[model samples]
Structure formats: structure tokens, C-alpha cells
Target: MPKHLNNQSSSVSLTVAAMGVVYGDIGTSPLYALRECFHESHGLPVTPDNVLGILSMIVWSLVLVVTVKYLLFVMKADNEGEGGMLALLALSQQSRPVDLRKGLNVVVTLGLIGVAFLYSDGIITPAISVLSAVEGLTLTTDVFTPYILPLTVALVALLFMIQRRGSGTIGSIFGPIMLLWFVTMALLGLHSLIQTPEVLRAANPLYAIQFLIRHAGVGILVLGSVFLVLTGA
Candidate 1:
């Protein structure tokens, strides 16, 4: 291939690999996030209005927080081409003036705290996601209902077992796997939307605002559940 064609191919490959590795969690989260909002602990009703409200909140949260804030803004704040809380902290410290050194210690301390929370999240997110997925098997066979916990554990263990191969190897397959996953999800969502096209009205922000006003305490719980969709992002 020509040099330009080779460069283009490499970029496309990297983009696909990135999709598989980086987007796996966020992509799978939709399986459980909306359902969790109506869990007994949240006390949110399953009424049409409430559902619309929750859906609206989820839509806007992804648009504003993930697309606008993280993709557009935070991704630009990299340290040596790496991005994360620690990278942002290092970049900030480097760009600070000498006069600001007095408070640098405090900033570093806070950054460490954020990193600690991130570690905790990494441990919890996979467990929750796998468990939720395994739970879905119960709908197909009642036998799975009894084995849910064990199956979840085994699947998660196998997932971690493969991690030794390193991210580069995993990422190479992730793009195609995630692409198939998303396409399946989109088709399922479209099928449901066809049955109830009115649900599209949830795109309005007013539904979210009205839901918050009507539900008050329950709204908090719904928002908490909705926040899960953003996890691993």
C-alpha cells in the first residue's frame, strides 16, 4: 500500500481497537441502568410519565457530561498524551506558576483521593455489570435463576483470567465485538420504539424537570440509578 493509505489503515485499526477496550463497560451498562431506577430501593414508579422523565435525564446526561464534557473538554487535558484524573493533575501542576506552589500539596492530596475512588469503581463496575448480565439469563430459563450467582462469578473470573494477555491483545478484538453489541442493542431499541413511538417525546427536557418535581425524594434515587449509565466512562 502507499504510505498515505497505510497511515489511514492504521488510524482506522486503532479507532476500532479503542472502541472494543474503552467502550465495553459504557456500552453494556444500558442493560441494567434503567431497570435499576425502578428498583424498590429507589421507590420510583413505572408509570409512563416517570419512565419518560428518567429516559430524558439519561439522554441529556450522556449528551452534556459524556459527549460535551469528557469527549470534547476533558480529553484535551492530557499529560504526555495520557488522560485520566492523575494525568490531569500532573498537567495542572506543571502548568501552575511558582507562586501557586504553596497550595500544590493540597491539590496533589485531592488528586490522590480521586485516584483512590477510581480504583474502587474499577473493582465494582465489572462485578455489577456481569451479575446483571447473568441475571438476564433467568428470563430464558428458570434453571438459571438458581445458578445466577455462581454463573456470574465464573464469567467474571474468566474475564479477569484473560487480562494477563494485556490490553493491546484484548483491544484488537473489542472493536468488532463492541460493534456487534451496539448494533444488536440499537436494533432492539428500535423494535421497542416502533411499538411505542411516543416514548421519543422523552427527548424533551421538560419531562425530566417535571419528574423531579413530582417525585422529589424518589427523583434522587432515579438520578442515582441514571448516573450508573455513565459509569466506566
Candidate 2:
């Protein structure tokens, strides 16, 4: 192959691999997020207006939180090609004046708390993703329903075991799996959009603002569920 062609192929391959390892949890959030938004506990009625409102929130949340916040801003703040809470902590300490650095014990405490949150999220995200995926089997038939919990537990345990081999190994194993998942889901979403093209109206920011204003109490609770979409980000 020509060198240019080879380089393009390599770029595409790396993008696919990154999509899996970095984005698998976010991809899987759809399995449960919409359901959680209208779950009985939230007392949200499943009307057309409500559906549009909730979807609008989801659309803007992805836009603002992931696209605008992470991709645009946060990703630009990396230290020496590294990112994450600890790296940011180190960067802050280095940039502060000696006199100001002494007052940064509070910053260190906050950074540690953020690290704990990230660690907790990593453990929780996979479990929820696996459990939600297994629960989808109930839609087809009840046969798998009885075993969902056991299967979820087994799958999560397997994931934990696989992690011991290092992230590179995990990425190599799961990258193609998640790439296939994303492609399958994209196709399904395209088909659904074809059927209900009107749903695209939910892309309007006004719908989200209206949703929160009209249903402030429930909307506040729903915001918690909406954040699920940001899990792997």
C-alpha cells in the first residue's frame, strides 16, 4: 500500500480502538438512561411533550458536558501529555508561587476526593452497564430473566479479572467488541429516526429549559439520571 493510505488506515484503526476503551461506558448508558428518566420512582409521565423534554436534556447534556466541556476545554489542559485529577494536582503545585503553594493543602484534599470519585465511578460504571445489557434479554423472553443477576455478576467478575492483565490487554480485547456495539447501535438509531423523524425536534435547547422550569422538582431528580450519560467521559 502507499504510505499515505497506510497512515490513513492506522489513524482509523487507532480511532476505533480509542472509541472502545475510552467510550464504551458512555455508549452503554443508553441501555438504561432513558428508562431511568421515566422510571416510576421519578413519577414522570410518558407523554410526547415529556419525551421531547427529557431527550432535549440528554442532547444538550452531551453537547455541553462532553463535547463543549471535555473535548473543547478540559482536554486542552493536559500536563506533559498526561491528564486526570492527580496530574492536574501536580500541575497546580508546580505552577503556584511558593507562598501560595502552602495554602494549597485544601486543593490537594479536593483533588484526592476527585480521584476517589473517579475510582468509584470506574467500578460502578461497568457493573451498571453489564447489568443493563443483561436486563435487555427480558424484552425477548423470560427464559434469561431468571439468570440475569447471576450472569451480570459473572460478567462483571470476568471484567475485574481481565483488568489484572493491564489496560493495554483489556483495550485490545474489548476495542473491537465495543466498535461493533457502536456500529450496531448506530444502525438501530438510524432506523428509529427514519420512523419517527419528528423526534429530532428534541435537539432544541428550549425544550430542556422548559422541561426544568415546568417540572422543577422531578427535573432536579432527573438531572441525576441524566449525568449517567457522562459516566465514561
Worst 10 residues of 1 by lDDT: 95-104
State candidate 1's TM-score: 0.89
Candidate 2, which segments miss by more than 4 Å at Cα?
1-9, 97-104
Give the 10-residue window scoring lowest on summed lDDT in candidate 2: 95-104
Q: Using TM-score as the measure, which candidate wins? A: 2
Q: What is the lDDT of residue 45 in candidate 1?
A: 59
lDDT by residue (tens digit), candidate 1, 120-143: 989989999999998998887898
TM-score for each of the candidates? 0.89, 0.91
* Residue runs of model 1 more than 4 Å from their true location after superposition: 1-8, 95-106
Residue 110's lDDT in candidate 2: 91
